[model samples]
Every structure is written in structure tokens, then in C-alpha cells.
Target: MSSPLRLILFDVDGTLADSQGAITGAMAEAFEGAGLPVPPRDAILSIVGLSLPLAMRELAPGQDAATVEALVEGYKSSYMLAREAAGAGHSPLYPGAREALAELNAIPEYLLGVATGKSQRGVEALIAAH
Candidate 1:
């Protein structure tokens, strides 16, 4: 017999959290630091669900492997710095974010977990802060 989707996996950015401002701001910083052009906010936000390297590649086309690696590292560093400056606050949860999570957690049959491309540390920090 097939089992139900007892586990609900949610993506972090733009899904669970309205993190467009923070992520796009950090991307701008990283691009400036790396001497790359900053993409539009929509462009930056569009790659939220992708893996780190893949996101970097998608956002920064024509980027060779090494440049992509550097961009990814730069983004991580910039994001962390921005988050710290912004008090490491919880990213703005979507409209039903808390309610949904609470509702799911309250259920005896459900388990909730995030399945985003963010680093383990980042996701852990987000959950802890939330």
C-alpha cells in the first residue's frame, strides 16, 4: 500500500518566508564585492528554490565554474553579514506560515520539515529563530 505524504517539505525563501528584500540586498552586496553586475530583485528572487551552486549559475549566466564558486561563497558571506546587521531576525513568514506550522505540528499524524536549498546552518537558525 502507498503511504500518504505524512511529511510536508517546504522551501524557505519566498515560500515559508518573504525574504526577497534580505536575499536581494545580500546579492547586491555580493555582486558589488565580486565586481559582478547586480541583477534585478525579481531575477535574484527567482532562483530561491535552487541549490547554492545551481542558484549562482542560474542567476549569473556565463559564469565559469570558479567564478560560480566564488559568487556562491560571496553570497553566503554577504547574506550572513546582512542578517547579522539586521539582528538575525526571522524572515517575514508568509500569511499562514505560523498557523500552518502550528497546525501541522499539532497533528498526531503530521511531521513538518524544511526542504530548501539553504545551508543546514541557515535553515537551523531560521527554525530556531522562528
Candidate 2:
């Protein structure tokens, strides 16, 4: 008798990868580039699970569309630059995450996947890095 397939989805940030530094730094740079006061770390972290546009909206409420869009673009640019500069270590996997994933992958009944607010490119980069 064969076991039923089980799907396991893990979040990228704060779960598989410890990306708080990259996230907060990009957010700060984005707000500064947009000439806005940077939100505190906690405030920024509060929107970690949201998409960039939604996150910018939450962080900079009442801002016009153009400003919000610019913040999103700035964040993307800053994050990409940081990632390029730091390479795979920019957002390293959490300790033992790789081994855990490997173990899970080795199980025939378990199918592992990711559920994250990160962009497709970002996810790909993380996967390629580790």
C-alpha cells in the first residue's frame, strides 16, 4: 500500500530564509530615496508578508499613487543591488533549512514548496543561491 501524497509549503522570509536584514535595509533605502521618513524596524517588519505595492501602501499610508509606485520601484532596485553585491549570502537560508528541505524532499510522500510574498525573480534567486 502506498501512502497519500502530502504537500508542505514553507514561507521564504523568516522561515526558510533569514531575510530581515535585506528586507529592512531595502525598505529604509526606498523610503529615503522617496524623501520620506523611514519607518521603525518593527513598523517595517509588520508588512513583511505583503506584496511590495501593498507593503508600501501600509508603510506610507495616504500617499499618492505615484509616490507609492516610486517607493515600490526604489525598494526593488535597492534590494536587487544589495543582492547583487552580497550574492547568495544576501538572504541566507535559516540554519538547518537546507538540510530540513533535503530531508523532506527525500520523502516520497512529501512534496515541498514555498508560499511567500517575494517576487518570482526573488524566489528564483534564493533557490539558485542555496
lDDT over C-alpha atoms for residue 51 of model 1? 81
Q: Which ten residues in a row have the lowest lDDT in candidate 2?
A: 86-95
Q: Please report the candidate that would top TM-score against the real structure.
A: 2
Clashes of each: 0, 0
Q: Looking at model 2, how many pairs of residues clash? A: 0
**Which residue pairs in candidate 1 have backbone atoms (N, alpha carbon, C) closer than 3 angstroms, thus clashing?**
none
Report the lDDT tens digits of candidate 1 across residue range 6-101. Answer: 887888887888788888877888778778999888888888778879888888899899888888888889888776666536377788988988
- Cα lDDT tens digits, model 2, 1-130, are 9999999999999999999999999999999999999999999999999988999999999999999999999999999999989988999998899999999999999999999999999999989988
The lDDT for every candidate, in the order shown, is: 0.81, 0.95
- Candidate 2 stretches with Cα past 4 Å from truth are none
Q: List per-candidate RMSD values in Å.
A: 2.9, 0.8
